[model samples]
Target: MYSMRMFLLFCVLCLMSSTGYSQLPGPPGPKGDPVNDGQHGAAGQLGPAGSPGRPRIPGLSGPAGPPGSAIFCGRGVSGQELETLKNSLAKLELVVNYDFVRRVGQKYFVSYKKRESFSRAVEFCSQRGLELALPQNEEENNILSQFFGDVYKTAWINVNTNKAEGNFEADMKNRPLTFTKWGEGQPDKSIQYTGCTMLSENAFWRVTQECFLNAYIICQM
Candidate 1:
């Protein structure tokens, strides 16, 4: 992981104890006639610099401020608000999908179906009271689509990756996957073992081994 450093912060504060700045009692009435015997201007000695501006009291350090909501990268959100949400999710005992300090929107997401392949991911979500992430807009799509990039084989989405057989068991036998977003001309329909799946951490669907292959699963509330 990489870390970034920011410049030091210099905060100027109002010096509470600093001496007040005032002009020497106005030039004795009217300079000319020596009106009131202009009390011989006591050899005006320059006053000492106002005690270094009261040592720049660092703006009174108030009580530790509460955290803000958490936003992941690219989500575009305020830090304080994001920290608040992160804290709330932390309290609820839900796993934090990603970093909380980023300036991105981080609506909590989960990966409950761990160690399970696409098929099992469906079952995991069903029994666990969660669903796969279903991004609605380009923001969501972009966020969900560009994860781990090409580095991973493929990732799963909220979309169901099953080959619906139309609830049919024709001829007292099983049927092939009627509908699926399989890789073009793929799934080798001739093989009964293939199942619809996705490239790890991705949007498109492909065919891998049977549904029993264990992999990571991502779920959203």
Candidate 2:
């Protein structure tokens, strides 16, 4: 029993000497570099992942995206747009005092006033230094036709048969002093001695009123 006890004690002492007493000298501190400080280190650890390597932030955000491209629309006009443009010209008046006005397509439409003999109409136009009646184009004739239609009459075309008895001639030549905006089917020779003229919408011209009737007329510049 005493020998056994002695052997156990010896074994314990050896184990203590091997483990507890032996101090491993820190790895030969690299020549001039220290171990504890990260100089040559194994002792200075990788420091707990260092807050995930500061999250590798991208350097400076790329330049701003290019400006958004513009879009394309259309060109043609229709409906109200068309009507609006047409009305703009039709209703336009360079001089507000002028009453007879309308749109003869591209041109401004107008006519003479009412209650004037053919001769008086011409004289009035001339005194104002204007042609008694001037039709700019076929469109103007048609537009004036519309006005006569509203009144149901034929119109004088500033022309007449007031020459050499039953003859027709020019205003300066055998032409009358004034004229009418005569519509279609006008001045029927049915009146025998009446060889006169007037205006109407539904061909009002044939009604043969006295020549001295006062009326308006278009002044030509």
Candidate 3:
């Protein structure tokens, strides 16, 4: 019986050696070096854009400036006042130009003492703001004739045949004479009487070819 038991025991021991048996765990082995830190990751892509901001409000305007000056903004003058001003100016002008040395009925005359040619006398009167004397009628003629009788023996009258040889015309009025006192057989049409007319001391009107003859000047206004 003892021998049989030994064989069985031997057989069990062999089985346990061939197949691993459960056992108490041993102390943990030394820890391995901690795993190296992982490599840093690549940068992330940019995020989507954000919405736009609100619009800004404008500032208020400043206060208005002061009123303009009166000289620039005053009312215009009335038409009646303007007309009165114009009339006053006209009267003032007439007064300024009323420088006559002699006067006849509704006529004003200025006699120059010096003698000059007919054209010169016209020019002289024109420079003085007057016209060469043009006796319109017998009354005017007689007045001039008497004046000449007292001073000069002869004077240039503003009558000429410049347009036509025998047709006389008043220089300023530009028409045929309304009155005449020609000497006997005057305006002879001869070369000597073809130039200009003159009033003699006797008040007789005579023509002479010598238009350049120096005679007294009488201007009228």
Predicted model with the maximum lDDT: 3
Q: Which 10 consecutive residues of model 3 have the lowest summed lDDT?
A: 91-100
Per-residue lDDT tens digits of candidate 2, residues 91-199?
4533254667665445554554454666776776677434555454555555655655343344444554443443332343453434344345544545444344444
Model 2 CA RMSD to the hidden true structure, in angstroms: 17.6
The most accurate candidate by TM-score is 3
lDDT of each: 0.48, 0.52, 0.72
Q: Model 1 off-target regions past 4 Å? A: 1-92, 95-107, 126-128, 136-138, 149-151, 158-162, 165-194, 199-202
- Over the full model, what C-alpha lDDT does candidate 3 score relative to the true structure? 0.72
Any runs in candidate 3 off by more than 4 Å, and if so which?
1-100, 149-151, 163-166, 192-194
lDDT of 1 by residue, 1-221 (tens): 12222221211122322445433475557556545654665587898876555455568778997976445675757878777777676634655443321122655455533456666676676675555554444455445444443434455654433334422111112334333343565544554533544444434445554656655565555
Order of the predicted models by TM-score, top scorer first = 3, 2, 1
- The whole-model C-alpha lDDT of candidate 1 against the native structure comes to 0.48
| Candidate 1 Cα deviation (angstroms), residue 62 | 40
